[model samples]
Target: MTKILAVRDLHLAMRTGEKLVPVLRGINLNLPQGEVHGLVGESGAGKTMLGRVILDILPPNAVVTAGHVDCATTGSQIKSGGRIFSNRGRSGISLIPQDPMTSLNPVKKIGKQMVEILQLAHTGPPRALQERAEALLAEVRIKKPKEVLKQYPHHLSGGMRQRVLIAMAFSSEPGIIIADEPTTALDVSVQRRVLRLIRDLQKERNTTILFITHDLGVVAKLCDKVSLMHSGMILEQGLVSEVFHSPSHPYTRSLLNAIPRYDQPREKLAPVAEDLQSQLIDEARKYDQQRQV
Candidate 1:
C-alpha cells in the first residue's frame, strides 16, 4: 500500500497564563493508502487534539511546537500557521467533527449546506452540483433525498444530522478522512448504523481513515490497526489482532482488562494501578527523545 499521510514527531501545546500545557507529545503516525487506523484514548488524552492538528485547526491559544506533517504527493512539511500546502494531494483531507448538532449551521437547509460545501470543492456546472449533493445524501442512506434536502438541520434527528455530516465529508471525495468520535452523539442502535455506514463507505471508496474513539468495542469492529493513547502519548500501537490478543503496554493491558466481559458477571473490572502513572511519564520522556533523533 502507498503511504498517504505521515506525521513525524508531531507535538502540540497550549500556552495558558504562565504555564505551557502540552497536549500532544512527540506523536508519530503513518496512514497508507486505503487503510483504516483507529486512535483510542479517554478524555484529555489529546485524541481530539491530534485530529485537529492533522486538519490544521488547532485552538487559538495552541501551537504546533515541534515536528512536521508531510502530505504524500507534495512532500512538503506543513507547520502550524504555515502555508506550505495546497489542495493538490489526492482527494483532499476532510474531517467529521465530534458533534453533529453544533457542526451544522442552524439556519441553513441541509441540502443548501451540502450544496455549498460541494460547490466550494468542485468547479463545475450548477446542474451537476445539485445531482452530486443528492447522490451523496443517498450514499449516506438518507431516505427521500429531495424531502430531506428541504429540511433544516434542526428538523432532522441526531442520527440523520450525523449522516448529513458524513455525507458532507465525503462530498469532497477525500483521500484521507479523520472522523473524531463519529458515533458518540447517537443512541446505541443509531451508533451501530452510523458506524456501519462509515465502514462501508470507506471500503467502497478505498479511503484512508483515521478513526478516533475511546471505545474499545468500536475499534475492534471497524479498525484494521490500532494506536492506544493515554495522557497525550501513544502508549502502544500495532496490528489490531496483536494489540487485542497480546497487548504489550501496561496501559493497554489495563484498558482491555477494564472492558466488561459477558462470561464473568460477578467479576469486577481491574483498576489501572497507580504505579502505571510513572511508567507513562517515563514513556513520554522516551517519546520526546525519539522526537529529537
Candidate 2:
C-alpha cells in the first residue's frame, strides 16, 4: 500500500511563558492510502494535538522538539520538521473538526462559504460552483442541498452542519483528512448517521483519514487500524480487531476493561485502576527524562 502520511518519532512541547511542558513523546504513526486509522484516547491524551500538528495548525507557543510529519500528494510533498508555514491548507490535507456548530462560520451564508472553499482548489464559474457545492452536500446525504446553501450555519441542525463540513473537507480532493471526534457533540442517533456518511464518503473518495476519538466502539465500527494514545504516548497500535481482542499494553488493556459491553453486563463501570494509571505516567515521565539526557 502507498503511504499517504507518516509521523515519525515526533515530540512536541508547549511554551507557557517561562515553562516548557512536554506533550507528544516520540509518536510513530503511518496512514496508508484509503484507510481510516483511529487515534483512540481519553481527553488530554494529545490525539487532537497530533491531528493539529499534521494540519500545521499548532499554537504559536508550540515547539517541535523533534520529529517530522511527511505527507504525499499527487503533485506535491509537504514535510514539516515541527510545523508548516504556508497557506496550503486547501491544497493539501483538510480537517473535519469536532463541533459542527462552532466549526462553520456563524456569519457567513452556507453557499458563500461553500463557494469560497470550492474556489480554493477549483476554478469555475458561479453556476459551476453552485452545482459542485450542491453535489458535494448531496454526496454526504444532505437533502435539499440547494436550500441548505442559502441558510446560515446556526439555522441548520448539528448533524447537518457536520455533513456540510464533511462536504467541504472532500471539496479539495485531499489525500488525507483529520476527523477530530466529528460526532462528539451530536446525539447518538444523529452520530450514527454522521459516522455512516463518513465511512461511505471515505470509500467513495479513497481518502486516508486519521479518526481521533476516545470511543472504542466507534473505532471498531469505522477504523481499519487503531492506535491507543495515553498521556501523549501511543501505548499500542495494530489492526482494530487485534488491538480490541488482544491488547498488548497495560494501558490498552485497562482501556478495554473500562468499556461497558452490552454482552458482558457489569455491576458498575470498572474504571482503569489508579495504580495502573500511575505506573504508566511514571514510565512516560521516565522516557521524557531520558530523552532530555
Candidate 3:
C-alpha cells in the first residue's frame, strides 16, 4: 500500500525557561492509504504531540529539532522549520479534537461553524454552503441536521457535538484525519456509536486516519495497524492482530495486561509494573544523553 503520510526520524522539543526539553525522539511513522492506524500510548507519551506535528499546529514553544513529514497526497515534504501546505483551501489533513466542548465555539451556531468549514473547500453562495453543511451532518447520521445546525454547541449532547465535529472533519473530504482521542469524553455507548460512525465514514470516503488513543480495546476494534508508543518513542508497530496477540515489547505486554479482560473476570487487573516503567525511563534518559553528546 502507498503511504499517505510519513514521518522520518522526527524529534521535537519544548522550551521551558532556557533549556529545551525533548518531547519526541527519533520517531518514524507511516500511514498507508485508506487505513486507520492507531497511535496508542498513555497520556504525555507524545502521541498527541506527534499528531500536532503532522497537522503543523505545534505550540509556540515547541521546536522540531530534526526530521520531516511527507504527505504523498499533497506531494509536499515539510522539513523541521517549514510549513505544510494543504490540498485545497483547507488542509488535506484535518483534526477531530479530544474535547468537543472546547473544540466548538460556544458562541457560534452549528450552522455558522459548518458553513465556515465548507467555505474553505469551495466558493459558493450561503444557501449552497448551508445545503452542503446539512448534507455533511446527515452523512454523519445526525438526525434533523437542519435543526441541529441552528443550535449552539451547548444545545446538543456530547455525542451529538462529537458527531458535528466528525461532520466538519469530512466536510472538506480530507485525505487524512488526526483523531486525537476523539471519543475520550463520551460515554461507553456513545463511544461505540462514534467509533462505528468514524469507520463508516472512512470506508465510504477511503480516508486515512491517525487515531491517537490510550485505549487498546478501541485500537483493536478500529485500527488496521497499531503503534505502541512510550516516552516519545515507538516501541513497536505492526498489524493490529499481530501486535495484540504477540506483543514483542515489554511495555506493550504491560499495557495489554493492564486492561480489564471480560474473560478473566475473576483475575485482578495488572497495573504496568513500576520496574518496567523505571527501565523505560532510564532508556529514554540514555537516548537523550546520547543525542546531547
Candidate 4:
C-alpha cells in the first residue's frame, strides 16, 4: 500500500516551568493511501498531542524533539520537523479538531468559513465551491445544506457542529483527514450517526483517516488498523480484527476488558495493573532515549 502519511521515530515534549515534560515517545505511524487508522489511549496518553504533531499544530512551548510528518502531496512530500513551520494554508492534510467551537469562528457564518477554506484551497469556481460545500454537508448526512450554511456556530447542535467540521475538512478534498475525538461530546445516538457518516464519507472519498478516540467500540466500527497507545508509547499495533480478537500487549487486553460486555453485568472499569503501569512508564523512557528526545 502507498503511504499517504509517514511518521518515523516521532518525539514531542512541552516546556513547563523550566522542565520539559515528555509527551509522545518515538511514535512511528503509517497511514496508507486509503485506510482508517485509529489511535486509542487514555485522556492524557498523548493522543491529542500526537494529532497536533501530525497536523503540525503543537502548542507554543511544545517542540517536536525529533520527527517528521511527511505527507505525499501532489507529486512530492510536504514535511515539517521540530513542529517548525506554520501550516495554515497547506493542503492534502486537514485536521477536524476535537471541538468545532474552538476550530470555528463564532463571528463567521458556517458558509463563510467553508467558502474561505475552499477559496484558500483554490478549488473550483464560486458556484462550484458552494455546490461542493453543500455536497460536503450532504455527505455527512446533514439534511438541509442551504439552511446550515446560513447558521452560526452557536446555533447548531454539538453533533451538527461536529458534522460541519467534518464537511469543512473534506471541502478541500484532502488526501488525509485527522479527526481528534470526533464524537467526544455527542449523545450516543448522535455519536453513532456521526460515526456512520464518517465511515460512509471515507469510503466515498477513499480518504485516509487518522481517527483518535478513547472508545474501543467506536474504533471497532471505524478503523482498519488499530494502534493501542498508553502513557505516550504504542503498546500494540496491528489490524483491528487481529488486535481486538487477540491483543498481544497487556495494555491492549486491559482496554478490551474495560469495554462493557453484554454477556455479563456491567462492572466498573478495571484499572491497569500496577506492574503494567510501571512497565509502560519504563518503556516510555526507553523510547524517549532511543529517539533522543
Candidate 5:
C-alpha cells in the first residue's frame, strides 16, 4: 500500500459578499494507492469541496488560503493550481460527478462524447476508439453496449448514464478518482448495481477513490477506510471496521447511532441530539481557532 495522495492542513473558503467564509478547516488526509477511502459527512461539511480541490475543479469563487496536495503519480507537490493550469495532472485525476444526467452532453451522441473523452487519454483509429468505448460500457455491465454507444444521454435511464460515467472515469485509468455521491439520485437497486460496478472496476484498475457519501451501509460495503467529517473537520478516521465497530468521537458515534439496523429494528431513527450537535460545532470551532495559532 503505497502513499498515493496526501492532503495536509487544508483550509479552503468561499467568497460571501465581502467576506471569506471558511468551509474546510485544517483538513488532513492520506490515501494509499489501490484503496477506497470514504468521506462521510452531512451536507455542507466541506466533503465535496475537498474532492473538488483534489481534482482541481474548485468553484470559481473558491479561495485556497492554505494547504497543499501531494500526488505520487503527478511527479510534484501541488501547492496550488499550477498542475491543473499547466495540464500536468489533469489527466491523472478524474471525477465521476454526482449527476450523470448533466455530466454528459445533452446534444451529443454518447459515442461521440465517449470518443472525445477516450481520445483525451488515448489515441488510435476512430473505429478502434469506438470499439474501446463500447467495451468500456460492456465492462460496466450495460446490456446492448453498442446501442448505448449510439444513444444520447437523455435517451438513457439515470442508472445507465451513471454506468457510462463510471466507465468514462476509469477509461482514463487515472491514479485517483473522486466519486461525489454518484448514487444519490438512483433507486435502491440501481444504486447497488452502480456501487458494485464501481467497486469491481476500482479493484480492476487498482485506482484510489475518494468516495463521498453519508450512507453508513455504502461505506461498510465499499470502503476500506472511513473518515467521519463534521463542521468541515474530520472528527475521526480509521479502518471501516474500527470506525463503524467502535466510533470514538461523539459525532461519529451519533452518526452511527442514527443508522437503522435491521438486526435491532427501531421504531424511529434516532437523529443526533441537538445539544450534542451544538457541542460538536463548538469543538470544531475551538480546534479551528487553535490551528490559527
Candidate 6:
C-alpha cells in the first residue's frame, strides 16, 4: 500500500531557558493510505507530541532538530532546521481534538461554526452553506440536523458534541485526520458508538487516520496497525493481531499483561513492573547522553 504520511528519524526537542529537552527521539512511522494506525502510549510517552509534530502545531518552544515529515496528501514536506516546503495552498489535514467540550466555541451556534469551516473549501450563498451543514450533520447520524444547528454546544450531550466535531472534520473531505484521544472524555457506550461512526466514515471516504490513544482495547478494536511508544521512542510496531498476541518488546508485553481480561475475571491484574520501568528510564537517559555527544 502507498503511504499517505511518513516520518523519518524525526527528532524534536523543547527549549527551556538555555537547555534543550528532548521530546521525540529517532522516531520513524508510516501511515498507509486509507488505514487506521494506532499510536498507543502512557502519558508523557511523547505520543501526543508526535501527533502535534505531524499537524505542525507544536508549541512555540518546540524545535525540530533532525529528519523530516512528509505528507503525500498535501504534497508538502516539513524538514528539520526550520525549513518547510509546500506544493499547495492549504494543508490537506484536519484534526478532531481530545476534548469536545472545549474544542467547539461556547459562544457560537453549531450552524455558525459548521458554516465557517465549510466556507474555507466552499464559496456559496448562506442557504447553500446551511444545506451543506445539515447534510454533514445527517452524515454523522445526528437527528434533527436543523434544530441541532441552531443550538449551543452546551445544549447537546457529550456524544452529540463529539459527532458535530466529527462532522466538521469530514466536512472539508480532508485526506488525513489526527484523532487525538477523541474518545477519552466519553462514556464507554458512547465511545464505542463514536468509534463505529468514525470507522464507517473512514471506509466510506477512504480517509487515512492517525488514532492516538493509551487504550490497548481501543487499538485492538479500531486499528489495522499499532505502534507502542515509551520515553519518546517506538518500542515496537506491527500488525495489531501480531503485536497483541506476540509482543516483542518487554515493555509491550508488560503493557498487555496489565490489561484486565473478562475471560480471566478471577485472575489478578498485573501492573507494569517497577524494575522494568527503572531499566527503561536508564535506557532513555543513555540515549539522551549519546545524542548530546
Q: What does candidate 5's lDDT look like per residue over 33-152, in tens digits?
A: 998999999988889999988877778888887888887765446554444334655677788989887889899999999999888778799999999999999999999999999898
Over 191-249, each residue of candidate 6 has an lDDT whose tens digit, in order, gives: 99999999999999999999999999999999999999888999999999999999999
Question: What's the CA error at residue 195 for candidate 4, in Å?
Answer: 0.5
Residue 278 miss distance in model 5 (angstroms): 1.4
Highest-lDDT candidate: 6
Candidate 6 stretches with Cα past 4 Å from truth are 83-91, 265-267
Candidate number that wins on lDDT, 1 or 6: 6
Where model 4 places Cα greater than 4 Å from the true spot, the runs are 74-89, 123-128, 267-269, 286-293
Clashes of each: 0, 0, 0, 0, 0, 0
State, as a TM-score between 0 and 1, how close model 3 is to the true structure: 0.97
Residue range 1-293, candidate 4, lDDT tens digits = 78888888777779999987898777899888889999999888999988877676667888777666677743333233423333543577788877766778999999888888888777578888787788778878889999999889999988889999988888778888889998887889988988998888889889999999999999999999999888787889999999999999878898788787778766665766789878888877786567555
lDDT of each: 0.86, 0.87, 0.91, 0.82, 0.87, 0.91
C-alpha TM-score for every candidate: 0.92, 0.95, 0.97, 0.90, 0.94, 0.96
Model 6 clash pairs?
none
Candidate 3 lDDT score at position 68: 89
180: Cα error in model 1, Å: 0.2
lDDT of 1 by residue, 1-293 (tens): 89988999877879999766678887889999988899998888899998877776677888888887876634446675574656554248888878898999999988789888887778888678888888999999999988998899999999999999999998888888999998998899999999999999999999999999999999999999999888788879989999999999878998899898888764677867778867787777786667669
Better of 1 and 5 by TM-score: 5
What C-alpha lDDT, on a 0 to 100 scale, does residue 3 get in candidate 1? Answer: 91
Worst 10 residues of 4 by lDDT: 74-83
**Rank order by lDDT, top first?**
6, 3, 2, 5, 1, 4
